[model samples]
Target: MTQIIRTSADLRDRVAAWKRSGILVGVVPTMGALHDGHMSLVREARKQSDRVIVTIFVNPMQFNNASDLDKYPRDEAHDLAMLEAEGVDVLFAPGVNEVYPDGFATKVSVSGISEPLEGAFRPGHFDGVATVVSKLFGMTQAGRAFFGEKDWQQLQVVRRLVEDLNIPIRIIGCPTIREPDGLAMSSRNVRLSEAERAQAPALHRIMTAAAEQIRAGAPIETALEQAKAEILAAGFHDIEYLEVRSVEGLRPMETFSEPGRMLVAAYLGDVRLIDNIAV
Candidate 1:
């Protein structure tokens, strides 16, 4: 059974005991909607550390749109069951108040890497991510952290955050898990309507093909334009962005580079889906 921790003090005490015993703790931070993608991170954590902690906090600060925040899928009972089954040592599902007390006034913001793509579309988002992630690191005091590569830009931002701040925790990025149909698994997928869900896998298919084209010597802009057109015709409401960027600095790349990642963000009905792959 996974111990559910809801307060900072209690989590600190528990981590202290583990540290005293020379146990290396690992943490998987999440937003309370556990899918196979999240489970993959937990499994990696279990394999890499003596103990594992999975945090489920639907951070209010990260959502630029209020409705999106309210609509974010959250089922603590189900999430806890999944963690317990994975042998997670703790679930730090803190309430908003617990994470951001009334007097809270600090924010962690990473510049440059965070100013494009998702950041450009969703304003002030990474500030919230950085702040909460830093808080989780301080609260859990884990030796390592796990994140999915599906949010490629996010992984980069968190990496930059850890390095810039000199945070002690090591950030481990796992591969993006996909469904049988090739659509990347995300907590927000539950909100996709039947028809929309049926058409959603095109995002991955189209991006994969485009990445291959770039690798095969096709022009980057030409491939992106074709992909955007295909995505729109595939029943997506809108294509916010579809481009290749440097894997490390996340700089927009017009020509194929040695290490690049192709990322996309499209809307299906009211749900916004993001996916990425190596180019």
Candidate 2:
């Protein structure tokens, strides 16, 4: 059974006791639509630490669109069952007021790396991510934190946050978990229509193919342009971006002289899907 701690003060006390006993803590932060992708992170946390705390708060601060926030999936009972099966120590599912209480005026912002890709398409998104993630770090006081590499840019922003702010926690990035057909698992996947769901896997399939081309010395722009056209033709409604960038700084890569990543954001109807691959 997992202990459900709904407030920061309670979580701190629990963490304090764990630390007093010299138990290493690990945390997996998420919004509550638990799927295999999220479970993979929990399993890693469990293996790497003495205790694990999985936080599930749909942070409203991160949403640029009010309707998108409202539509975000959440199921506490189902999520709890999954956490229990994973033997998670705590489910830090706090309310909005609990995380951002009255008079809470602070915000955590990481610039540069956060200004492109998802950040450009979704404004003020990473600020909410940084703010909530920093608060979670402080609240959990865990020695290690696990994040999925599916959100590669997000992993970078968080790594930068911990380094710049000197927060004492190790950030571990696990590989992106995908379905057999190759669609990356996401909470938003639930919103896709039956037809859209079938078309969604093409994002990964096409991105992977483009990445291989870039590696084989195809002109970066030509490869990306073809990928975008193919994705739109493959039944996607629109493409936000299909770009090759440096894995470190996320700077646009023209020649692929260094290690790069192929990242794409395409829409299958109103549900925008994002995926990335190594190049």
Candidate 3:
């Protein structure tokens, strides 16, 4: 059976002990809603490390709206059972009080790149993400960390964080897991109603259409404008952003380039969904 650890101090001591023995540690950070998407990360970690430590904490700092934070899913018993089945080695689950003992007065912030796209929509989301991820890397002392490309911007921010701070951890990005209809799997996906769920695939369709346009030598602006129009016409309430960025720099593109990313976010009712594709 995998060890279930619920306190920070115990996780610290156990990881520290593993470090002295020179064992490879892998960390997978997540909130406590275990899905197949999350299991992909856990399995990847288990394959690569001598021990895998998965941290399940719903981070309050990441949510700008109180309702969104309050409504975020929680199924601790199910989450633990899923992790144990995936051959997870250790689970580092800490309470909000345990994670932010000082009440989150300190935070991590990345400049420039974060202000565009999703960051523009949710003010301090990345700051919360960066802070919590930094703490996870420290607590686990992981040699490698796993993330999904579904949150491509987040993966980029974390990659930059590790590089800039000289944190000795390798980031392994797994491919985005998707529903059969192509909607990327997310904890937030549960919020969609049957009708809303039917419309959810529009986000993925938009990006796939953009990729085809880019492949056909269309201009970047033309592709984005067409995709935005299609999404709005399909009845999505608000289009937050549709950006084609250099995969390396995450900057707005003047022209479409192969091996780039097309990122889109839209609101259906009040639930926001993001999807991206490589072109």
Candidate 4:
């Protein structure tokens, strides 16, 4: 059985015991509504560390839209079953007050890399992520943290935050897990209508096709524009951004580069889908 530990104090005590045992700890921070994508991170943590802790607290500060936050899926019973099946050692499901007490004033914000894409589209989203993640690291006192690359930018932000602040934790990035149809798995995907669900995989298809084209010497802007048009045609109405950017620093790329990735964020019905592929 996986132990469910809440409250930072209880977490500190358990982590202290592990510290005494001299075992390496890995933390997988998630928003609950556990999916195979999140399990993939737990799997990686299990392999890489002696002990694993998965945090399930959908931090309210991370959601820019109140409704989106309100609608974010959560089922602790189901999540715990999945974590137990995965052999996770502990599941830290903290309450809002446990994680964010009254008069929580500090906010962690990363500049430069966080400015474009999701940051620009969802104002202050990364700040919320950074702050909560920082708190998670402190609470778990884990030596390594695992995050999936499905959220490429968010992964980068966490990496930057850990390094900039000298948090003394190793950040391990796991590859993105996707459906057989190629749609990146996300909690929000469940909200898509049946028709929208059918069209969702096209986002991944477009990024892959665009990546190949760019690699084959096609003009970056031309490939991206064509991808944007195709996404709209595929029934994604709000094509927020479709860009090819450097893997590091996330600088926009207009030409072939060794470490570049093609990223897209579009909406199907009301569900927002984001997918990225290496270029």
As a whole number from 0 to 100, the lDDT of residue 250 in candidate 3 is 88
Clashing pairs for model 1 are none
Q: Which ten residues in a row have the lowest lDDT in candidate 1?
A: 250-259
Q: Across residues 1-279, which tens digit of lDDT does each residue of candidate 3 receive?
A: 789898878998898899999999999999878799999998899899999998999999899989999999898889999988988889888988889987458778887777788899999999999999999998888999999998999999999989989999999999999999999999998998888999888878877988898878999888889889988877687888888888967887787654788888888877888888998
Off by over 4 Å in 4: none
Runs with alpha carbons beyond 4 Å of true place in candidate 3: none
lDDT of each: 0.93, 0.93, 0.89, 0.92
lDDT of 1: 0.93
Please give, for residues 101-200, the per-residue lDDT of candidate 4 as tens digits: 8988999999999999999999999999999999999999999999999999999999999999999999999999999999899999888888888988
Candidate 2 structure quality by residue, lDDT tens digits, 38-139: 999999999999999999999999999999899998899999999999899999999999999999999999999999999999999999999999999999
Superposed by TM-score, candidate 2 places the C-alpha of residue 38 at a distance from the truth, in angstroms, of 0.5
Give the C-alpha miss distance for residue 70 in model 1, angstroms.
0.6
Residue 71 shift from truth in candidate 1, angstroms: 0.4
User: Model 2 Cα displacement at 165 (Å)?
Assistant: 0.6
How many Å off is the CA of 190 in candidate 3? 0.7
